[model samples]
Target: MIRVLFYSAVSFLLTSLSCSAEQKRALEYTVSFEHRAAHYAEIQMVVPTPATGTIELMMPTWTPGSYLIREYARHVDHLHATSDGKAPLSIQKTSKNRWLVECPIGKDVRITYQLYCHEMSVRTNWVDRDMAVLNGAATFLTVAGAESTPHRIHFDVPEDWSRSMTSLVAVEGRDHTYVAENLDELIDSPVLCGNPVVQDFNAGGVPHVLATIGDSSLWDTAKAAADVQQIVARQQAFWGVVPYSRFKFLNVISETGGGLEHDNSTLVMTSRWNYRNKEKYEDWLSLVSHEFFHTWNVRRLRPVELTQYDYETENNTRSLWVAEGLTSYYEDLMLVRAGLIDQSAYLKRLSKSIEKLQTNPGRNVQSLSESSFDSWIKFYRPDENSSNSRVSYYVKGCVVGFLLDARIRELTNDARSLDDAMRLLYQRHSGPKGYSNSDFAAILSEVAGTDMNAWLAQHVETTDELDYQPALNWLGLRFAASKSEGTVAETKAATAPTNEAAREVKPAETDETPNDKREEPRAWIGIQTSDGSASVIITGVTHDSPAHEAGLNVDDEILAFNRYRVNSRTWRDQLTQLGIGETIDVLIARRGEIRTIEVKPVTEPTEKWNLKPVAEPSDEVKARLAKWLASQ
Candidate 1:
């Protein structure tokens, strides 16, 4: 028996050494969704290798495009390794998301693991009886130092679930086999498996697919498809070329809001009723356009820091304002260009962004570059102080993009604009090498025929207030604010007025009617709440507001309002019940002490900003607007 054992071990060693000499490397990933109802997937990977030492594999901590680190390795379990079915291979856990596999040189190894994927988001993976959304980063393992090696994926799904959708091209003559040039490409392509409404269209002579993974009864698929196709064609024309051979949009209508852009596709999550409402549906289309534009802006013309990604750490850069913000700026502009929305509607959206910036006190505290750099910590994790301390690069960046475009047009007599800058940047750095922050300034100057040093200093690098008038002035537009005031009816719990008496209270003898105001005045106390179950806690207090003036502190839990019990749901109603200028007692628990504070409700002024064309314009201004709007 001992002689037989020795002979067997010798034979296995010989086979491994022979395999190592060939130095052949191949990755075959088999994913099974038959047990998806249990919120897990069984994955098997067969790797043929030539390495003499240990093979290290790593699971990415975060997916690209999503700034937050999700620690996807935590969801992986039931890990086992084998070598040519000869004997169990030695595997060691090296780090939180890394494993070292002991392999005799040239030996073939197989790794089997189960992944729990209950989370539902564009960047994460999810599975259920009905459908599965698989993000490649969260589902695949990367063989350290072998990222450039070609890999193939095979899906083993239930017989009933026949449909599958992904941006990856399938291997010819291989059933369910898809090839990725490298691990990065594999990680960029997400797969959606299950029954879905799939629609195909051609834009700019490139094939496009729209796969909706939920109930599609409410949406007019044909109309939506045509609109989407127009957006694609318009963007293709704007960029002057289509980067990818084919593009796909994987949409999940299980919830509202968000999308993550990829190399050749984008995963969009939206409300089930998004199509039923005109505004919601327009927002959806804007989302689609936003992600598609990213195919050029970030996916190709990326920032220097993102040119080569390190999945284990954050790829922070001060240029996301251009990556994400510029994409946002074009979302609505592309819609207008595609005739999905009129110029008037586009102005409304732009005006809305201006209003948001003006209202956010954080705009004065955070620079666009700082906002982009700290996105990993600040942008994704918002607290009450977020509004007061940090501005959104997205909101302010779009405003800057608008101003930049107008500045370029103004300088060149509409001969060159921001589009010229984009084309130049794309031409120069459309690959593995990304542009730096200074590079953009240089490009903008070259396109505008002027020095942009001061422009970058004042806007991108500092928190100086932006003056929209200059840009608006050049575009034959003016920013105007009109004040229309209204009085709020007072209601007292002890001596509450009847409905008739409430009507009798005159609205402070004003010429302004209810119709004149764009938005009705609301009683402002300026206290924001955190997510709570039993009682609402004050998470923030706006500066100089009644809540701040009355000594309301963040983390103070509100127990009652004016002697009445109140929680998060009832607090807003309690405040709205009181009339403007009315004082009420607020019972709050602060530092283990209960106290009553006198708080008065006041009518707050809500500013309405609009960028309207000048009532009468000079011929040059009119010509600028016409030409600007007419460009791709």
Candidate 2:
């Protein structure tokens, strides 16, 4: 009798523990797309009520990676709540994204709402007759205090929709149901409900799915998928680890642009016709490489500031330069290393980034750290003067990354590169407890065998002009000569030869006539104009330019230049005909009032920043370059 009683008690304890586990996952959601044609998704949630007699629900204000407050609650309509007995419960809006509901104690509560999801971006939700792309942050509302608890979602896909795809773990014996370990996993996983062209491949012994929607038979799906596998293999080799069990690349060929990274998957949108063009297709591949690199950079090894995300409000960080900029730097490099693009193509792409940074006047105003911190306000919300005041962390950070990589190579005599530093950082801090700015510098210092804190601070914290001499010399590369008389400061710095071998190499010339050979300098009005139906509207005026000095404001209609009638098509040509240092009458219409402003055109600044290898590189330099660009 004693043994029998002991066995019965142990069984009872095990049953109680199982019941407790089930209760933690008692929240169930059913999403139906009955009105998808109208771009509506109906959501039904069932929650197990606590003994407190009240519960709060919250819809996330913004999704991760986008860094903008989208106010997802604005799309919710016809929200209602009820008790287990079907009795109506009192529901009140406590905040813009929160709802308070009163229900019977120790009972279950049912809540239903309709969401209108028509936004076409990767961060938001979109549903039409043909398909539905749903982001969890914009689609589901969670019980406020129960975010750590498991949540199950069931998709009642439409009859015409073939299947649903996501990175979430599927529930066994259920047709379209999936479970999330926690709210974070649910939000990180995006779902696609449609008949997308699915392709499967394995890299690093891990399964990957490439699902392309809206193909329309225009995309080279097979080749794209094969190339994507190569990218995956290259990136995995770089990291030396495959972090996830499986991965998915949710490609949407919706004639759109942009991509958002997730933990185990990514959503990338592009036009179907991009595959036919070599440059555009390579650009799409670059996009893929960028988002994939984030799996190791931001998604896992992140800054301390972004270690824990606050979904309700802005999560500020001064390390987006490292997160996004480093990713930007590696995106194209990865493509070359994967053998998808040749070395020439890679250099061309890198040169464009350098050119963009050199031309943007904001590089002198905002430091990379400031750009990362103020991305919520200044980066996303740009005005006419943004170009003069705000720099892109992605651009400057990428340039800085290139210089940093070269600096490391120089310090260690090519014995160690930035790749070692990244791997070391990942080994030390790729977890919930992220590293600080100083921590990142320490890693670089360790790899380079020298302290880099001061160097890092000067580049990240101050808006100081970057010195490109080290990178140019170490890489045995030079900037192509400018067509205009006054080349930018960086061009002058790059022109200095590294060795006697470099002296034998003739500087690469642009397609335009040389500055000394040209008959006249190119005249610049310094205004970017848009072609309106009836007039040429000034959209932007460069800072300290002739247009800005003459008070040429944005939105001013330029009816003519030098009193000669000119539209947007003819304005530039006519402006070019005018002599530099000569003031000409530019007629304008401000708010329908006819006016004329005198403006002096100056010689256009040289903006060429093309990078090319030295024509006569020494054997040593050639070997270094090979090591830098070779596949891992």
Candidate 3:
């Protein structure tokens, strides 16, 4: 009697399952590639249940990850609606990116449109005879009020294409069919279809796929996979959890080079032959690490201002340094932690950033927070005076990250570091509504168990010069300026041993020249040039320099120097052979007006900086140094 009851219950459950499956309406999208020859994609969206009063569809003006509004709807044309039985429905253009449809109630509606996709970018769509990359924001439309509705997508690939890849989950027992839970997820997932080489691996017990679109025969994809696996493992350990079950790394080999991060995947464009060179290969690895780290940073631990993205306009925030700059700091740091790069190489990269920040006059004009806020206008749109007026949040932010890590380590006595603070942010602020900059400062202080208000106010909120002393002193090192002309490392510090101290007060090798063998001092023109033109154009004249004092403005064409025809390629060499404090005749064409002037060149400024170790250090200093530079 119990067996008979169980059989009847199973039969009823099976019947109810079948009925539910039959009742669920299918929301399907079909993308056709037959018309790709004209750079057009035919997209048809089928809605099983039509709305009663009015139905509105919208194409996003821009995509996430990339902040600019590209107006994706401009590429759409020939859009019309029809009933499931092929009866035409009336449609009207409501806005720049919106379309309205008027149809009878309780009828199925199918909207068909054509997209002209020739722009080749990570955020846009590109279709050719060889391959097709479809970004959801540029290809799909959403029902105005039904953004959370589930979507089903099908691709009609070309005959030559062998496979398709995306991060979205695939439908059961279906070929090239995927499902997205909502409009945001659909836009976040990009589809690539072509005869590409794909390699799959498991990192931290999670599946990861690397897909290559262009020629990759020269690339050692196995080595890349191993390195990426290491990166994934280290990052997993850092955050203590992996958010996504499966991830994808989509690499498109082309002449252009860039990378964009997504929720569960990343798209990178690079040269086909980059793997052949060691430095280029390491750079590629750094790029991979940078984008992968974003999975936790900007994608989740974003600023409150960027918690909810606005697709139609600019979303401004004062915390991009935390987003992009801190990411920049970790790009190379992760490389070292993964054993892909050494400590020396990491320091070299850090010193390079220091040189950039120290040399660019813009650092004195723009604060780190202000630079982050004005990125949409000032950072992206730059002029010749940009170096003199604005600083990059990326460069300065990396420096700040370095300083903060060292300071935190000093305060916690190697028991904690910035890594701990980052983990706290990830655990507490990973939400749709993110924490603000003030909240971040507070969290940082709380994690480090110290007051960071003064540091944050001085370095981040204002344009005050950064003091590298705190960081360098902790490492038993000092910052010094270089006087050597060729090498970036001219290792003489302020307290460095002098000739007398080294030679036991033997002899002075000072600026004294033998009477018979006097050498001419080197001269500086202080004018940067642009080459490959009929006449050399002065690109810039340094402030308070001889060229600036002589009124040799930018864009002034140099006709001759010392009565000799001046070539931009040889001008620097000529100046090198001249003596300091010597006046030279210069013929220039200022705004098409020819004139001659005599200007005296002076000695060049010694501003190139270097990082050098201290001669003698305290035991506490040595211990701190070891703790800071210890193996990650």
TM-score per model over all chains: 0.87, 0.92, 0.85
Spell out the clash pairs found in candidate 3.
none
Q: What is the lDDT of residue 578 in candidate 1?
A: 70
Worst 10 residues of 1 by lDDT: 488-497
The Cα error of candidate 2 at residue 410, in Å, is 0.4
By lDDT, the better pick of 1 and 2 is 2
What does candidate 2's lDDT look like per residue over 1-632, in tens digits? 00111212334544543465475745789999889989999999998766688999999999888878889999999999989848999999999999999988888999999999898989999999889999999999999978777778999998888989998877667888987767898999999999999999988867899999876488878889999999998888888877777789999888888999999899999998899989999999999999999988999999999888888999999999999999999999999999999999999999878766766668778999999999999998888777778889988899999999999999999999999999899889998989899899999999999999989999899987778878887887878775453433434336432332221111111223444456656677677666445568877777777888899999998888777898755776687787788999999899889899999987665544678786677899888888888735
Model 2: what TM-score? 0.92
Stronger candidate by lDDT (2 vs 3): 2
Off by over 4 Å in 2: 1-23, 483-520, 531-534
lDDT value, candidate 1, whole model: 0.80
Ranking by TM-score: 2, 1, 3
TM-score quality measure for candidate 3: 0.85
RMSD of each: 11.0, 7.3, 8.4
How well is each residue in 151-221 modelled by candidate 1, as lDDT tens digits? 77898778878777887767555666676667888899999988888889987666789988877788777
**TM-score of predicted model 1?**
0.87
lDDT for position 461 in model 2: 94
Off by over 4 Å in 1: 1-24, 480-522, 530-539, 559-584, 590-593, 600-602, 617-620
